[model samples]
Target: MVIQSGESSFGRDSVTRATSPFLPPPVTHRKDCMSAAVKRYRYLRRLFKFEQMDFEFALWQMMYLFVAPQKVYRNFHYRKETKSQFARDDPAFLVLLSFWLFVSSVGFTFVLGLGVYEFCKFLLYVIFVDCIGVGLCVATVLWYVSNKYFLKPNYRGQDVEWGYAFDVHLNAFFPPLIILHVLQLFFYHGLPILHRTQVLLYPLVPLFLTFIVSLASGWNIIRTIMDFYHYRV
Candidate 1:
């Protein structure tokens, strides 16, 4: 027998309950959907309130992503324990990521000595193509793949959340964003060994990201960088 009940999410109103041997789920499911909508509405309302966001924790997450990534994985476990959700409830990390994205782009503009027009183009590519475009495509694919093949049969009514999948992408992207876009600028002119290092580094990027840019997959970062190098030379 299934039980049916309606309770106001906004108030401590009484829940009127009824039970039947063959009650359909549509009615109860609607209440659940409405509750989720309320929570989502409240979350969006907090997005503009900077003081309410936990930027300190988000910044720690960014640093630990490189130093101790397992810690970041545990963060979700902790959230699941406390909040019953594997995805982040706060958007502070996302806000910090956007901040770093622009900061790194500005460094890239200066290090590459791009003109005003070129900088504008590069900024658009970074914002639209490199980050959002790639992130959305990768996150959607992984979300589908994980739910389709990776989920355990025992876990009913619990699959990979789309938001958690995107969070995984953000956590993974943060380190490379720092290394390639931020730290690389420091070595742009100072590194005399970069030319020699390419012979070794060229193979690493593609090899490390084979699932992403294997010869069978798509354009590889190392290959693109080499093409640019040859063009300049």
Candidate 2:
């Protein structure tokens, strides 16, 4: 009796619970774990089906993440209420992230004047090592820590899913990835040192190097003046 009670958990209604014997249950009758497994399986399967993914909703979520993150949370809440899970069901956001990573790598290739061999190597490292590998490690560590240390004693049959943790990391990574990796290249063009290097590498540009260098380097003098008169605040 005690063993049976220990195995049981309060149902969603909070009045009673569905339980089983100490032995394994038959496959014909699905259990709580199987339902979660099915959800995970379906989510992974959708990762390969680009046409079936909802990319428009994913882009909307990305935009709102910067403007109004609360609106995105409301959608997450709705999904949990309807689907019984907080992890995403579609893989569109991940696809978009990968797309941006590829585009950035390509831009760097020409900007750096990388050879064909170097370009291929750089592409592989950024996509696989820098992004996917780091993401997996971070997701697994946080998932274990959250489940092990944060769980309430009374909250039986409840835990954080690993997929949800990965989803969270992806959401947080998107903005910084765009700002730092994609946007910083533009600023480099306006910097004196980088502009000189660019002019040397591409002689097709009609601008004189001395004129470009003086114009670009004036920012240093402006910065020095600003530093001398530090703001009172």
Candidate 3:
């Protein structure tokens, strides 16, 4: 009787092991992992605008802004119609490019090279001093001027979003900034210093051009906002 009982107990143990509830099926485990990965990928796509702007389109838009400002502006509307309102025209590429140009300009200023410490300091100054303070100050002025002057004539009592103003300002800055840096690379190095107080001539041209273009685009941008509010331009 004892031997028979032992054999029965062993059989029960084998059955339990074979059909354990804690052990997930192989196919189920793979599906769960794949689902998790897909979810993560979707989240990333939304956060970064990965699906909206591809590499070629991004390059074309930035270049097109100079040659055809009106066309570029129109493209923004097309994107809004097709994509969500939150989908922006410039995307992450331009923003990254702007920062790259700024840093490269600073680095190129030093003919030799930068040490680890100096490089770190330059980066900090670019972010905090140049980008945060100066960039914000310029954008704020653009926003204020557009709202005060242009929008009032067309769309009275409607306030323009700072985001729109900032985007326009940043994009306007890119071409001029690139031109200034190119001058810095070639001409600025060779020019003789006239006086301590006088501004460098090579960069002044591009800087002035940048300001004019920014102002004009700013007006157009305000018009866009007015149109968005259902007001006639």
Candidate 4:
């Protein structure tokens, strides 16, 4: 009888142990989930604010960078197409490149003539001009690539339309030149008072403008390329 009782007690304990694992415990608030949700909300809010600030800043900067100058040099000639099938053999871009190099060299020489007080001024001018020229050359190469591979069908009226690509290329190429010329006039002609702070800020304005324009243009190109790929697929 004692053995039977011991066996019965062991079986009951075993049954309780087995049931306890399967049964749900008393309800407890999950602090971890609540904390994670709060973190996610705060992160999203921060991201939204950042995006808004970026847009506002870019808009303000772009207006000062592009629009004000447009009023001054509205008559400037902008070359839209440097290469087409009819002009495939033309060396116009090469000539333009050579001309820019010569002009840049002359500018550098002038900058070199200035004494210590004006060295920074000259250096800033040269840097801005060179960056603009380099950007133009790069835009030309991208234009050619787009024309050859991406725009060919549109040119032939076969299927693809790359009008947007052409427009983007044009938009990307012109601003740098405009900014360069504006800065050149601003510094060389002494239109703006040459405070030390102004001198430093002046070059930065154009450089920043160039950077933003390039970024926007690159984004457009990438989107277009992706669209083309998607369409082809």
Candidate 5:
């Protein structure tokens, strides 16, 4: 009787194993989607290696750096512990981010300005002259800061990476650029439409927010600079 009972249990186990799927259909689909996303992210990261250390993480770090630069600053300095050095101190990342921001500002400028065409001549000029010029200026400024400030004598012997300086400068500059673009958006249309509606005061909301963001960005930059100074000396 005991032998028969054991055989019955074994038969049931085999049947269950044969009928049950390894994973539910929803779970399998989700896993496959996640894997594909990871693969795509890796491919993009490799393609843009110089400018984007990690495609997704860089965006998040930029967001964090704007809001909490000190944390990102420290993480960059102490990379061994934090393992976030790539996102913060990648030279290509800085160049690309700076260029991206510059392009965004330029695009917004074009949108806010007269929607007129100059036989593609003015567009070419803005793309080649204004965008490239602004990008180069940002790079030069970051390079200057790297050499002038962070590379100075360090009493604590904590070495400063040039890339980190660039990262800090990029983060410091991003807020003002972003806020200025937003302000331009409101200044361009919101006020004009509100004025037409006779709602003169409503337009101040976006302007006020932009002003506050600009101030916050400046403060964040000051905090980052102070942190760098402390790290230096």
Candidate 6:
């Protein structure tokens, strides 16, 4: 009886150990999966924070560029022309204008080169900056044309009524300019200077800026034209 009891007890102990191995492995696997998930989440959170910081920095940089001495010089020169026709017809003014046009064109070409390089190198931040630069170039061109032809003619009129024509022109120019400038802040300054990552995000910056400018321009044109029509009647 003692021998039989001993053998049965040993068999029961062996069965219990066999089942315990299977149970522990499943529990271990679950723990490992959870740990991996937690690690991935943390990594993603850090990446997002980094990107946000980059964007903010880029924005500050763009503002600084826009308000720099060169920008002031340009603005003053343009405004002076509007007030005094002397500056308008001056050969020097044309030379300066030509210089600016050439500079801007060169800058735009450089931006394109940089953007392509960044895209190839997988540097997202640089790409974004390039995009912003392109947008600024476009905005500058639009501003020049609007100021030279549209705003100047109206302001030059001896009895220029502050009527629909004036309103429409201002409306058309200001809204698009503002929108493009805002986009420039995001694409050129925010993404590249701040984040310093040359990633896919850079390309989107230009596209967004362009979209905003186009939308604003279209809306302003329609609104201004409608206002002029109403005033005429």
The whole-model lDDT of each prediction reads 0.71, 0.70, 0.54, 0.41, 0.50, 0.38
CA lDDT for candidate 5: 0.50
Mind giving the per-residue lDDT tens digits that candidate 5 earns over 1-233?
A: 11212223323333343335662332222322323345335545665465445444455556766666664454443342223222232343445565665566556657756344542455465445544455456756766765567665753333333344434556666676566644556555554534456567788999788769979876565677799999999
Rank candidates, lDDT, best first.
Answer: 1, 2, 3, 5, 4, 6
TM per prediction:
0.67, 0.65, 0.49, 0.26, 0.41, 0.19
Ordered by TM-score, highest first, the candidates read 1, 2, 3, 5, 4, 6
Clashes of each: 0, 0, 0, 0, 1, 13
What's the true lDDT of residue 76 in model 5? 47
List RMSD in Å for every model shown.
14.0, 15.1, 21.8, 28.9, 18.5, 31.3
By the lDDT metric, which is better: model 2 or model 6?
2
Locate the minimum summed-lDDT window of 10 residues in model 4. 77-86
Error of 4 at 90 (Å): 1.8
lDDT of 5 at 155: 30
Kindly indicate the candidate among 1 and 6 with the higher TM-score: 1
**TM-score, prediction 4:** 0.26
* Poorly placed runs, candidate 3 (over 4 Å): 1-53, 79-90, 102-106, 109-112, 152-158, 191-233
Model 6: lDDT equals 0.38
How far in Å is the alpha carbon of 120 misplaced in model 2?
2.1
Across 1-233, the per-residue lDDT of candidate 4 in tens digits comes to: 11212223323333343336564331221222223245335534554353333333223323433556441122111111111111112122223433444454455446446564465565455445554445456656775675568755445532222332322333344456445643464456454554565566678888788769979877565677799999999
Residue-by-residue lDDT tens digits, candidate 2, 164-194: 8888888888888788777877764575644
Q: Which candidate number would show the highest TM-score if scored against the true structure?
A: 1
Over 4 Å off, model 5 = 1-47, 50-52, 80-110, 113-159, 193-233
Please give the distance, in angstroms, between residue 173's alpha carbon in candidate 2 and its true position after superposition: 1.3
For model 2, how big is the CA root-mean-square deviation? 15.1
Decide which is better by lDDT, 1 or 4: 1
